[model samples]
Target: MKTQVVIIGAGPAGLLLGQLLYRAGIDNIILERQSGDYVLGRIRAGVLEQVTMDLLHQAGVDTRAHDEGLPHEGIELLFKDARHRIDLHGLTGGKQVTVYGQTEVTRDLMAARAAEGLTTIYTAAPVSLHDFDTAKPTVRYQKDGATHEIACDFIAGCDGYHGISRASVPGDALHLYEKVYPFGWLGVLADVPPVSHELIYANTSRGFALCSMRSEHRSRYYLQVASDQKVENWSDESFWNELRLRLDPEACERLVTGPSLEKSIAPLRSFVAEPMRFGSLFLAGDAAHIVPPTGAKGLNLATADVGFLSRALEIHYREGSQSALDRYSELCLRRVWKAERFSWWFTSLMHRFPENGEFGQKIQEAELDYLVNSRAASTSLAENYVGLPLESF
Candidate 1:
């Protein structure tokens, strides 16, 4: 089989890229190692930036999102037993975020692809890329006891961190930078009204806690725990009890507890692989970088990456110029680094670090005080939180 572009993985990044390319009249095929149900089963963050929303509109999958997604103009921060509100809309001149689950986004993209009769092969395993360094690149995969080869002009590596896309790069060619944090987030999804109308981020003596929701009734909450923490050890009652201790009195009173629909513990880490382009193979989303989720930038970053990539590919096909394609890495890295800094800073400010001791606690408090009171500092936070603009090619 031959196509213009072969996209690996059927996650949001891969599916969204396929949709954009299809609209641009580019022939592309998506290969996924898992079934469609498995992809939607994986729970992820929901916060969506304006830029992401606009991209969805461009892809023609914004109908459901616009009808069901909840919009928030501000977030409340808890410190010193007091709750402070950051007007994200006001601080950023009417910019706001929407609470929409990543799963829903993937579902919308997948449905759009199916309606258009796009080519997406699921359960295509043992995939490999060859000759990416030269002009002609080909992808090989095994399915139904048979090996299939796809000759393509380019390959997109959206299979995520552990996938073969990044692994295919020679160690010497890829510069990897990573920092594993000392704590992890124990998250729970329950079908109950949220603790508040808007999300609340708490910095307390116990630990850091965030109260977020996918909709008005589906609440997603998180608590900072030791890196070695086990999900099986915490019962539903215990989890709620612990969460109450970390919240302010008012929030605790308003909090509603219920059976958890899903529970998991994920370690925090910041990782980036430099120069996202490896010859004809390009990496987007988790294949390129990862942020701790403190700033809710994980999915947003992936959207930005593919947005730039799709535009670059469009220019390459339409204008017959390689300038945008060559500049893809440079443009993506500039924004990727800024998001890394923001996630790192937000994680450091909210979590309790035993290694930092009392000094760290005092310093965090001082900074929180300044951040809430000073308009300049709050504006900076709002700007980064809403997300930095995509650079023009």
Candidate 2:
């Protein structure tokens, strides 16, 4: 089959890109290594920065989100038994974040694609890319035990970090920057009211804990754990007990415990693959960069990456100009690096490193103290958290 573009992976990045392209009258096909059920079943963050919400609206998937998603003007940082709220909206000139799950975003995009009859192949096995460096690119994958080939003008590697998109690039063509933290986040999703109306990020003597929610009745919480920690080792009761210890007294008193619906451990890491474009092939979202979840930048970053990519491709097709297409990598990397810096800094500030010992702990406390007290520091945090303007570099 022949198409204008071939997208690898049906995750948010790939799916969002397909929707954008379809709306622009551009023909594209998506190849997923897993079924639609598997993609929707994966649990992910709910925080939506301003730009992400705008992109969702642009893609015609914001109706449900606007009606049901909770908006928070600020986030609270709990340290030294005190809660300090950073006024994100006030600090960022009226920008705020929405508590809308990534799963919901993907589902909405999928529904739109289905209604429009856009082509997407689920459970496409052994997907591979070829001739990306040439004018004509091709994608091959197995479907129902049969091999199929698709020739396209360009290839979008939106699969993910471990997907073939990044791996297909030769070593000399890609420069990787990465940092894997010594700890991981053990997250639990439960059917209970959240501890607070706004999200709380706590830095306590026990560890780092974040109290977030998917809705009024569904809570998602995370605690810092050893990099090798096993989820099987902690029961629902034990997870709640540990979480309570890290929270302030009021939050502990207000917390409602319930059975966990999902539990998992995710390692913290920041990674960026340079030169997001190679010939006719382009890398977007996690395929090009990954930010630690501390700043809740992963999904938002992906949205921005694909937004830039779609615009670039749109310009190429509509205006017959390759300027935007050629500048895609440079523009995306500029924003990617800023997000990586914020995520790394936020992770380091909130989490306790074993090697840092008491000295590092004291410094972290000092940093948090300064952040909450200084207008400049808090504004910086608020701006980055709500998201820097998509086009601002």
Candidate 3:
């Protein structure tokens, strides 16, 4: 089979890219190692930056998002047993974030692709990229006890951190930078109303806790735990009890507990691979970088990457120029590093670091005091939180 581009993975990044290119009249095929149900089953962060929402609109898949996604104008920061609100909308010129699950975004993209009769081959395993360094690139995969090869002009590596797209490149050609945090986030999804209308980020003596949601009636909460923490160690009652201890008295009084629909512990890490482009192969989303969920940048960063990639490809096809394609990494890395810094800074400020001891706690408290009181500092936080504007291609 032959197509203009071959996209690996059927996650939001891959699916969104396919939709964008398809709208541009670019022929692309998406290959996924897992079934469609498996992709939607993976629970992820729900906070959507305005830039991500704009990209969904550009891809023409924001109908359900606009109808069901909850928009928040601010977030509360808890410290010293008190809560302070950061006016995200006011501080950032009326910019706001939407609480929409990543799964729902993927589902919307998948539905649009199906309606348009786009090609997405699920359960296409053991995929490999060939000749990406040359003018012609090809992707091969195994399905139904047979090997199929797709010849394409370019390949998109959206298969995530462990997929074959990045692995296909020579190790020496890619420079990897990574920092594994000392703790992980024990997250729970429950069908209960959130304590607060807006999200609350808490930094308490116990640990860091986040009260987020997928919708008005569904809550997603997290607690910082040791890196080696096991999900099975904490029961539903214990999780709720521990969460209440970390919250302010008012929040505790309003908190509602219920059976957890999903529970997992995810380690935090900041990782980036320099030069997102390798000849005709390009990496987007988790394949290119990862940020701790502290700032809710993972999915947003992916959306930005593909937005850049799709524009570059469109320019290549329409104007017959390679300038945008050549500069893809430079443009993406600039924004990626900024987000990485914010995630790292936010994580450091909120989590209890035994290594940092009392000094760290005092410093964090002082910074929180300044961040909530100083307009300049608050504006900076709001600007970054809403997402830095995408650079022009």
Candidate 4:
């Protein structure tokens, strides 16, 4: 098969790029290894930055999101049994964060794609990159045990970490920067509704706990755990007990415990690939970088990258010039770094570090207290969480 552009992976980045190209009347094909159901079901980041919401609104997919999504003015911080609420709206001149899961975003994107009746290949595992450096890049894949070849003018390697496209680039051709944290997060979803009206990020001597929810009836939460933790080790009682410790007395008991719907421990990581391009093949989203879930910035990062690159591709096609395409890597790296720094700041502030020196821990706590009470400090966070850097636009 042939196309003007072949996007690898049907996740947010690839899917959004495809939709954008569709709107621009540029034909493209997306090949995803996972089934559509799995892709749409995998629970991930929920916080949608202001810029992300703007993109969705402009794309005509925000109607359902706006109707069902949870709009949060700001987040609460819990420490030493005291709660501090930061007014994100007041700080950032009305910027807000939307609590819509990554899975929901994928669900919306899938529905949008199906409604459009565009052709896409799911369960197509990419095996190799063919002629990636040439004008025409080919993706060799096996779908249903049958080998197939997809050729295109340019390939958007939106496939995530552990994807073939990232590895296909020779080691010497790319510079990899990686930071793996000492601990991971044990995320849980309960059928019971959230105990509080706002999200609470708590730092406790035991560990860190995050309080989030999907809807009025479903609560999503997390606990800090060992990086090598196995799901079988954490029981319902322990999960609730940890939640009890991190939460304040006022809201802790009201946190009605319910059946655990989802459970997994994701390792904390901060990674960025420099110059996310190799000839005509460019990396996007997780393929190019990863921000810890601390700031709920992963999906936003992908949306920002695809939004920028998609427009760049449109310009290249309309003007028959490659300047935008040539600058794609640099363009994406700027936002990627901004998100990376913010995620790091949020995580470092809220999560307990076992190896932290006494002064380091005190500094973090002091900074958190100041930020929560000071409009200037909260505004700094509000701006970053609202979206990637505005200067990029």
* lDDT (C-alpha) at residue 61 in model 1: 94
| Candidate 4 C-alpha error for residue 332, in Å | 1.1
Q: How many residue pairs clash in each candidate?
A: 0, 0, 0, 0
| Candidate 1 per-residue lDDT over residues 161-245, each given as its tens digit | 9988989998899999999999999999999999999999999888999999999989999999999899999999999999999
Q: Score residue 179 of candidate 2 by CA lDDT.
A: 94
lDDT by residue (1-393, candidate 4, tens digit) is: 888888888887788888888888788888888899888778786888888887786566787779989999988888878888878787788878988877877777777778998768998864678898888778888988899987788888898987877888999888989899999999898789888878888977777899999887889989998887898899888888888888889877688997798888889999998889898888999998999998888988888888887888888899998988888888889878888999998998888887886666678788888887787888888788777454443
lDDT over C-alpha atoms for residue 197 of model 2: 96
In the range 144-189, model 2's lDDT, one tens digit per residue, is 9999999999999999999999999999988999899988999999
Could you give the candidate ranking by lDDT, starting with the highest? 3, 1, 2, 4
Q: Name the runs in model 4 displaced over 4 angstroms.
A: 357-359, 389-393
Q: Work out the TM-score per prediction.
A: 0.99, 0.99, 0.99, 0.96
Clashing pairs in 1: none
Q: Model 2: runs farther than 4 Å from truth?
A: none
Query: After aligning candidate 1 to the native by TM-score, how far in Å is the CA of 282 from where it should be?
Result: 0.4
